[model samples]
Target: MTVILNQSFTGISIGAVLLLIALGLTLTFGQMGVINMAHGEFIMAGAYTTYVLQKSISSAGISLLVALPLAFLVAGAMGALLEWLLIRRLYTRPLDTLLVTWGVSLMLQQLARDVFGAPNVQTHAPDLLTGNMSVAGVTLANNRLFILGLALLCALTLTLILRLTPLGRRIRAVVQNRDLAEVSGIATERVDRTTFFIGSGLAGVAGVALTLVGPIGPTMGTNYIVDAFLVVVVGGVAQLKGSVITAFALGVLQSVLEYSTTVSVAKVIVLVAIVAFLQWRPQGLYTLRTRSLV
Candidate 1:
C-alpha cells in the first residue's frame, strides 16, 4: 500500500510536468492550427536559461525564482519573433508550418550544442525543495509537491485568463471565426502573437520544473515531447480542462504500468491504448464547438 501510494504521488508529479509542457502546445496547435515542431526547442531554451541562471546567481533559491520570469520572457520573446519571421507566413499551410518548425527545431538543437556544449548540466533544487516528508510511510519529495502546486496554479491562472479577461474573449472569438472576429474589430494578429507567446512561455516554465527531475541537456525537451503531444491530443485540443485531466490520467497510468513492466513496454502499451481510444473517438475526450478554420 505504501509503495502504491508513493507511485501515485510520483505519477501525479510526472503528470504535472506533462500538463505544463502540453499547455503551450495545446494553445498553439488548437487555437491557430499550427503544428509547431520546435515547441520542444522552446522548452530546451528555458531549461538552458535556468542553467545559466544557476551558474550566475550561485544561490539555488534565488536563481530558481529569477529563472521563472526570465525563462518565460526569453522563451516568449523567441516565440514572438519566430511567429513574426516564419510562422506568420505559413498560417494557412500546416504542412509547411510543420516542415519549417522541424527545421527550426534542428537549428535550435545545434545552437544549444554550440553554445552549451554536448554535456548535460545539472540544476540543483532550491534549499526549500531539497528534502522529503513522510506520511503514513509514503515519502513525498518537496520538489515534486512544489511542481504539482505550480501546475495547478498555472492551470487555474490560464483558466481565469481565458474565462474572465477581454483578451481571452478575443482569443476565443478569433478561434471561433477569424473573419468575423476581424470584422468585429478584434486584433486577430495581436491575439495570435499573444497566444503563441503565452504558449511558449508555459513551455519555458515546464523546462524549469523539469530541471528538478533530471539533468538539463540540449535534447532534454525531446524526451517528453511525444508524451506532451499525446496529452494535448488525447485531451482534445483547445480544451484546457480536458488537458489537465488527461495529463494526470496518462501520468498515473504510465506510472502504474511501469511498476509492472519495463518503461519502454509501459510506454508502448500506453500508446496502444491511446491509439485505440482515438480510433473510437477521434475528436478526443472533450471538445468545444468552434468553427473550422476553413
Candidate 2:
C-alpha cells in the first residue's frame, strides 16, 4: 500500500509537469491551429530566465518568485513577436507554419548553445523546496509539491481567464468563427497576438517549474515537446478539460508502468495505448464545437 501510494504521488507530480507544458500548447496549436514547433524554445527561454535571475539575485526564493512573472513576459513577448513577424502570414498554411517554426526552433537552439554553451545547467532549489515530507508513509518531495500546486493554480487561473474575462470571450469568439468575430467588430488580429502571448507565456511558467525537477539545457525543451503535444492531442484540441484529465491519466499510467518495467518500455507501452485509443476515437477525449463553415 505504501509503495502504491508513493508511485501514485510520483505519477501526480509528473502529471503536473505535463499539464504545465501542455496548457500553453492547448491554446497555440490546439485553439489557433498552428503547429508551433518553436513553442519549446519559449519554455527554454523561461528556464534560462530563471537561471539568469538566480545568478544576479542574492536570494534563490526571491529570484524564483521574480522569474515566474518575468519569464512569462520574456517568453510571451517572444511569442507575440513571432506571431507578428511570421505566423500571422501563415495562419491558413499549417504545414508552412510547421516547417517555418521547426527552422526557428533550430535557430533558437543554436543561439542558446552559443550563449550558454553545449553543457547543461542546473539551478539550486530554494531551501524551502529542497526537503521532503512524509504523509501517511508516502514521501513527497517539496519541489514536486510546489510544482503540483503551481500547475493547479495556473490551470485554474487560465480557466477563469477563458471562461469569465472579456479577452477570453473575444478569444472564444474568434476561435468559433474568425470571419464572424471580425464582422462583429472584434479585432481578430490583435486577439490572435494576445492569445499567442498567453499561450507562450504559459510555456514560460512551465519552464520555471521544471527547473526544480530537472536540468536545464538548450535541448531540454526538445525532450518534452513531443510528450506535451501528445497530452494536448490526446486531450482534444481546444479542450481545456480534456487536457487536464488526459495529463493526469497518462502520468499515472506511465508511472505505474515504469515501476513494473523499464522507463523505455513504459514509454512505449504508453504510446501504444495512446495510439490504440486514438484509433478508436480520433477526435480525442473531447471535440471543440466551432461555428466556422469550413
Candidate 3:
C-alpha cells in the first residue's frame, strides 16, 4: 500500500505533464481542424528555451518564474509561424496537413540536432523549486509538486479565458461555425492564429515542465506527441475539462500497472483500453455542442 501511494503520486506528476501537452493538442485539433504532426516541435523549442534561461539565471542570473511564460511565448511563436507558413495551407486538407507537419517535425528535429547535438540537454531546477515533501507516508519531489501546481493553474487560466473573455466567445463561435462567425464580423483568421499560439505555447510549457523530471533533447517531443494525441482523442476534442480527467486517469492507471509490471506492458494495456473505449463511444468521453467542423 505504501508503495502504491508513492507510485500514484509519481503517476500524478507524470499526468500533470501529459495534461499540459494534451490540453494544447486538443484545442488546436478541435479549433483549427488541422492535424499538425509538428506540434511536438514547439515542445522542443520550449525545452531549448528553458535550457538557455537556466544558463542565464544560474546562481542568481536567471528567473525560473519568468522562464515559465517566456517558454510559452517562444513555443507559441514557433507554433504561430508554422501555422502561417505550413499549417494554414494544409487546413483544407488534413491528410496533407499531416504530411507537411511531419516534414516540419523532421526539419525541426534535425535543426535541433545540428544546434544542440544528438546528446540530451540537461535543465537544472530553480533553487526554490528543489526539495522534497512527504505526505501521508508518501514522499513527493518538490519539483513535481511545483509542476503539478503550475499545470493546474495553466488549465484554470485557460478555462477562464475560454469562458469569460470576448476573445473566448469569438473562439467558440469560430469553432462552432466559421462561416457564421465571419458573417458576424468575427475575424476567424485572427482567432485561428491566436489558437495556434495558445496551443503551441501550452506544449512548450509542458516541455519546460518535463525538464523538471527527465532528459530534454531534440527528439524528446516525439515520445510525448503520441501520448498527447491519445489523451486528446480519448477525452474528446474541444472539451478541456474532459482532457484533464482522462489524462490524469490514464496517468495513474499506467503508473499503477507499471509498478506491478513492465512499463512497456503497462503502456500497451493502456493503449488497448483507450482503443476499446473509443470504439464503444467513438465520440469520446465528452462531445462538443453541434459543430459543423468536428
Candidate 4:
C-alpha cells in the first residue's frame, strides 16, 4: 500500500510535467494549425537557460527562482522570432512546417552541443528542494512536490488568462474563426504571436521541472516530446482541461505499468492502448465546437 501510494504521487509529479508540455503543444497547434516539430528544442533551450543562470548566480535558490521568468522570456522570444522569421511563412502549409521545424530542431540540437558540449549537464536543485519529506511512512521528494505545485500554479494562471483577459478573448476569437475575428476588429496576427509566445514559454517551464527528475542533455526534450504529444492528442486538440486530465491518467497508468513490467514493455502496452482508444474515439476525450474555416 505504501509503495502504491508513493508511485501514485510520483505519477502525479510526472503528469504535471506532461501537462505543462502538452499545454504548449496543444495551444500552438490549435491556434496556428502549425505542427511545430522543433517545439522540443524550445524545451531544451529553457533547460540550458536554467543551467546557465545557475552557473552565473551565486545562490542556487535565487537562480532557480530567476530562471522561471528568464526561461519564459528566452524561450518566448525565440518562439516569437521563429514565428516571424520561419513559421509565419509556413502557416498555410503544415507539412512544410513539419519539415522546416524538424530541420530547425536539428540545428538547435547541434547549436546546443556546440555551445554547451555534447555531454549531459544538470543544474543543482535548490537546497530547499534537495531533500525528501516523510509523512506516515511515505516519502516525497521536495523537488517533485515543488514541480507539482508549479504545474498547478501555471495551469491556474493560464485558465485565468483564457477566462478573464481581453487578450484571451481575442485568442479564442481567432481560434474559433480567424476571418470573423479579423472582421470583428481583433488583430488575429497579434493573437497568434501571443499564443505562440505563451505556449513556448510553458514548454520552457516543463523543461525546468524535468531537470528535477533526471539528467539534462541536448536531446532531453525528445524524451518527453512523444509523451507530450500523446497527452495533447488523447485529451483533444485545443482543450486545456482535457490535456490536464489525460496527462494525469496517462502518467498514473504508465507508472503502474512500469511498476509491474519492464519500461519498454510498459511503453509498448501504453501505446497500444492509446491506439485502440483513438480508434474507438477518433475525436479524443473532448473537442472544440468551432466554426469550420472555409
The 10-residue segment with the lowest total lDDT in model 4: 285-294
lDDT, candidate 2, 164-239, per-residue tens: 9999999878866778899999999999999899999998999999899998999888988999889988998756
Please provide, for model 1 over 131-216, each residue's C-alpha lDDT reduced to its tens digit, 9 standing for 90 to 100: 99898999999999989998999899988998899998888787667889999999889999999999999989988888888898
TM-score of each: 0.96, 0.97, 0.95, 0.96
lDDT of candidate 4 over 1-294, digit per residue (tens): 999998888788889888888888888887877878778989998899889998899688998888898888888888888888898888788768978988999999999999999999978888899999998778999998898898889888987898899988898878777888999999888888999999999888877777777888889888888898888788887557888899999988889889999789989999999999899777678877755553
Clashing pairs in 4: none
TM-score of 3: 0.95
Best-fitting candidate, scored by TM-score: 2
lDDT, candidate 1, at 194: 97
Per-residue lDDT over 1-294 for candidate 3, one digit per residue giving the tens place of the 0 to 100 score: 889899889789888988989878887888877877888888888888888887887752255666779989999998999889877777778778877899999999999999989999787787667778878889989889988998899999988999999988888888777888999999888899999999999988988887888888989888988888888888987568989998898889999999989999999999899989988878788877673454
lDDT of 1 at 114: 98
For candidate 2, the 10 contiguous residues with the lowest summed lDDT are: 285-294
Q: What root-mean-square deviation over C-alphas does model 2 reach?
A: 1.3
Error of 1 at 109 (Å): 0.8
lDDT-best of 1 and 3: 1
lDDT of each: 0.89, 0.91, 0.86, 0.86
| Model 3, runs deviating above 4 Å | 291-294
State how far residue 88 of model 4 sits from its true place (Å): 1.4
